[model samples]
Target: MNILTELAQIGNRLDPKGAISFPIYHSSTFAHPGFGESTGFDYSRTNNPTRQVLEDAIARLEEGTKGFAFSSGMGAITTILTLFSHGDHIIVTEDLYGGTYRILEEVFNRFGLQVSFADTSNLEAIEKEILPHTKAIFTETPTNPMMKIADLHGIARLCQKHGLLDIVDNTFLTPYLQKPLLCGADIVVHSGTKYLGGHNDIISGLVVVKGEKLATRFGRLQNSLGATLGPQDSWLMIRGLKTLALRMKAQEENALQIAQWLLNHPKVTEVYYPGLKNHPSHATQLNQAKGFGAMLSFRVKDSSLIPRILKSLEIISYAESLGGVESLITYPATQTHADIPLEVRARLGIDDCLLRLSVGIEAAEDLIRDLESALR
Candidate 1:
C-alpha cells in the first residue's frame, strides 16, 4: 500500500468500534485488573493507548524499531542528550536549528556535555573535530533558515567507522520526503510541531530508534523525564500526520515555483533551495532523499526591503514557526537564529538580509504572486 494510505489507516485496527478516527484515551492512569496485575499501562507518563498508536505509526513510517513522542521538540532533544554522560562530546552541524544550538550551548554545556560545531557537509571537517570523548554526530539536513544539506550516507558511514551514534533531525523534511534511518542513521528525531503535525494546532516531538537496545534506553529516559506527549496532543499529531503526504507534495511544488521566481526577481540576491541545480548540496540531496523539501531561504538585495516586505504581505504570514497549512516568512537573524551570537550567525551566513520561507499547500501561482507583490 502507498504511504499515504498507510498513514490514513493508522489506528484503525485498534479501534474497538467501526469508527474511522482513533479515539483518544483521556485517563491518566489505567485501573489494574487486580493486585500485581496491570493492564499494560500503570501511568500516563509510562504509556497511554492513544499516544502509543501515534508512536507506533511514526516508527512504522520511519522504518525504525520503535518510536517515542514528547511534549515538545526541545524536550525530545533534551531527553536524547541524556543518553550521553557528562564528559561525553558530540559533533553537530554548524547551521543547526537555533533551539538545538541554544540547548547545547546554554543548558547541556553547563551540565558538562561538550559539543563541537562543524560543517558536516564537509566530511573532512567532521573527521577533524572528533575527540576521544565524542560519542555521537547530530545533524539537521537542509538545515534551518539556510537550507544547507548534509550528506546522510556519508555521515552514517563516518559514525559506523568511529563507533559514533548517527542522529538526524528530520523536522524540515519529515519521513514522507526523507527517511534518515534507512540512509544508515541510528536515530531520527522530528519536531512534530512542524511538518509531521501539518497544522500549527499542536506542539510535539518524536524520536525513532533503529534497534531494540536504543529503544529501550530512550523509553526509560522518556518516562523518567516525564516530557511525554499528552494523550490529546498525541491524537492531534496523528490526525495531522494522516495528510502529510498530500501536504508535503503540494508544499514542495509550491516552494519550487516560488524559489524559481525569487531567483529571477530584481530584489532577490540569492535563493537557496536544494531543488535548484546550482545549490551546492543539490547532488548530495538527490542521492539521499526523494524530494527537496518545501523550506527555502533567500537574501534580498537590500536589508531595508525586509520591513516593507513583511508589512506588504497579504496571504503569507510573517511568522516564527513553519510547516503549517499557511505559508510563513521568517527573519532568521531576529526570529529563528537570534539566540546564536552575532559572530557565529555571521560566520554561518545567516545575515540580516536573509528571509526564510516555509511553503504551504497553497496554489503555486498565488504564492508567487504574493511574493512578487511583497518584493515590489
Candidate 2:
C-alpha cells in the first residue's frame, strides 16, 4: 500500500470498531482479561491504544522498528539524551536549537555527559571532534534558523566506522519529505507538534528507532520519564498525520515561491533556503531527501527593518513556532535562539536582522503579496 494511503488510514486498521477516525482510548488503566492474563494495555503511561496507533504510524512512516510519543519536542529530545551515561561524549550540531543547547549545557553537562558542538555539515570537522568516549552524533539538517544542511550519508559512514550512533532531527522536513533512517540513520526525532501535527493545536514529539533493541531502550525510558503524550493529544496527532502529504506539498510549493521572491527584493540581503538553486546545500539536499521543505530564513539589508517587518505583517504571523497551516515569521536573536550567547549567534549568522519564515498552505500569491506589503 502507498505510504499516503497508510498515513490516511492510520488508526482504522488498528481499531477493532472499524472507526474511520482513530478512537481516543481515554482510560488510564485497562481491566485484565483474567488473573495471569493481560489485554495488552496495563496503564496509559506505559501504553495507550490511541497513542500506540500514532507511535506505530510514525515508525512505519520513518521505516523504523519502534516509535515513541512525548509531551513536547523537548521531552523527546531529553529522553534521547538520557540514553547516554556519565562520561559519555556526544558531538552535536553547531547551529542548534536553543532549548537543546540549554539542556546540554545546563542539564546534561552538570550530570556528566561530555558534549562538543561542531559543524556537522563538514564531515571532517565532526571526525576531528570525536573522542574515545563519543557515543553518538546528533544533527539537525537545515538546522534551526541558520539553515545549514548536514550530509546524512557521510555522517552515517563516519558513525559506522567509529561505531557511534547516527541521529537526525527530521522536524524541518517530515517523513513525507525525508526519511533519515533510509539514509542510514540509527535514530530519527521530530517535533511532531510542527509538521506532523499540522496545526498549532497540540504539542507532541516523536522518535523512531532503526532497531528493536534500541527502540526498547527508548520505550523503557519513555515510560520511566512519564512525559508521554496523552490519549487526547495522540488522537489530535493522528488527525494531523492524515493530511500530512497534502500539507507538505502545499507548504513546499509556497516556500519555494517565497524564497525566489526574497532573492530579488532590495531590502533582503540574503535568503537561506535549500530550495533555492544558489543555496550551498541544494545538491546535497536533493541527493538525500525527496523535497526541500517549508522553512526558509532571510536577512534584511539593515537591522532597522526588523521591527517594521515583524509588526507590519497581517497575513503572516510574528510568532516563534513553525510547520503549521498558518504562516509564521520569527526573529532568531530574540525569539528562538536567544538562549545561545550573542557571540555564538553572530558566528552562526543568526543576526538581529535575520528572519525565519515558516511558509504555510496559504496561496503563494497571497503570501508573496503579504511579504511585499510588509517589506514596503
Candidate 3:
C-alpha cells in the first residue's frame, strides 16, 4: 500500500463502528470481563484504545515490530536511553539537537553514561570513535539545523558487525521520507509534535523497535516511566498524521524554491539543503530517502543582516520549534545550539549569521516575497 494511503487509514482498522474518526477512550482503566481474562487495553499508561491505534499506525508505517508513544519528544528519548547501563558509551552525531546534548551531558552523564560526538556523515569517523564500551550509535541524519546526512545503511551494517544497536532519530524526514528501520536500524524515533503531528498544537514522541525482545523491554520501560501520551493528544496526533503526506510534499516544494532563492541572493553566503545539487549529502539522500525534506539552513554575509531579516519577515514566524504547517525561522547560535559551548558551536559552523528555516505548506511565491522583504 502507498504510504499516503497508510497515513490516511490510521484509525480505520481499530474503529469497528466505521466511524470516520477514531474513538478516544477517556477512561484511564478498562473494566475486565473476568479475573483471568481481560481486554488487550488495561490502562492508559500501558496502553489505551485511542493510543493503540496511533502506535500501531506508526509501527506499520515505519516497518517495525512495535511502536510506543510518549508525552513529549524528550520523554521518548529519555526512555530509550534507559535501555543502556551506567557504564555504556554511546556514539552520537557531532551536530545534534541541543536538548539531546543537554540530556546526555547534564542528566545522563551524572549517572555514568558516556558519550562521544562524531561526524556521523562520515561512517569512518563514527567507527573510529567507537570504544569497547560503545553500546549504540544515535544519529540524526540531515542533522538538526546543519542538514548533514549520514549513510544509514552503512551505519546499520557497521552496527551489526560490532553487535551494537543502530538508533536513528527520524524526526526530520519522518517515515514519509525515510524509514530507518527498513534501512536495518534497530530502533527509530520521532518527535511527532513536528512533522507527524503536522500542526504545532500538540507535543508528542514516537518510537518503533525492530525485534520482539527489544519491544518487550521497551514496553516495560515505557510503562514504568509513565510519560505516555494522553488519549486526547493521541487523537490529535492521528488527525495531524492523516494530512502529513499532503503537508510534506507541499512543504518540500516550498522549501526547494526558497533554498534556490537563497542560493542566488548576494547577502546569503551559503545554503544547506539536500535538494540543492551542491549539498554534500545530495546523492546519498537521493539514494536512501523518498525526498530531500523541507528543512534547510543558510548563512548570511554579515551578522548585522540577522536581526533585520528576522524582524522584517511578515509571514514566517520567528520560533523555536520546526516541522509545522507554518514556516518557522530559528537562530541556532542563540536558540537551538545555544546550550553547546561557543567554541563547539563555532567549530560546527553554527555562527551568528546562520539561520535554520522550517519550510511549511504555504504558497512558494508568498514565502519568497516574505524572504525578499526580510532581506531588504
Tens-digit lDDT string for candidate 2 (1-376): 7878988888885667777887889899999999999989999999999999999999999999999999999999999999999999999999988989999999999999999999998999999999999999999998998788999999999999999999999999999989999999999999999999999999999999998789888899999999999999999999999999999999999999999999999999899999998988899999999999999999999999889888999899998799999999999899889999999999999888899999999999999999999999
- How does each model score on lDDT? 0.93, 0.94, 0.94
Provide backbone clash counts, one per model.
0, 0, 0
Worst 10 residues of 1 by lDDT: 11-20
Which residues of candidate 3, in runs, are more than 4 Å off? Answer: none
The positional error of residue 165 in candidate 1, measured at the CA in angstroms, is: 0.7
- The digit string of per-residue lDDT tens for model 3 on 113-192 reads 99999999999999998899999999998898899999999999999999999999999999999999989899999999
Q: List model 1 lDDT by residue over 206-257, tens digit each.
A: 9999999999998999999999999999999989999999999999999898
The predictions' CA RMSDs to the true structure, in order, are: 0.8, 0.8, 0.8
Query: Order of all candidates by lDDT, from best down to worst?
Result: 3, 2, 1
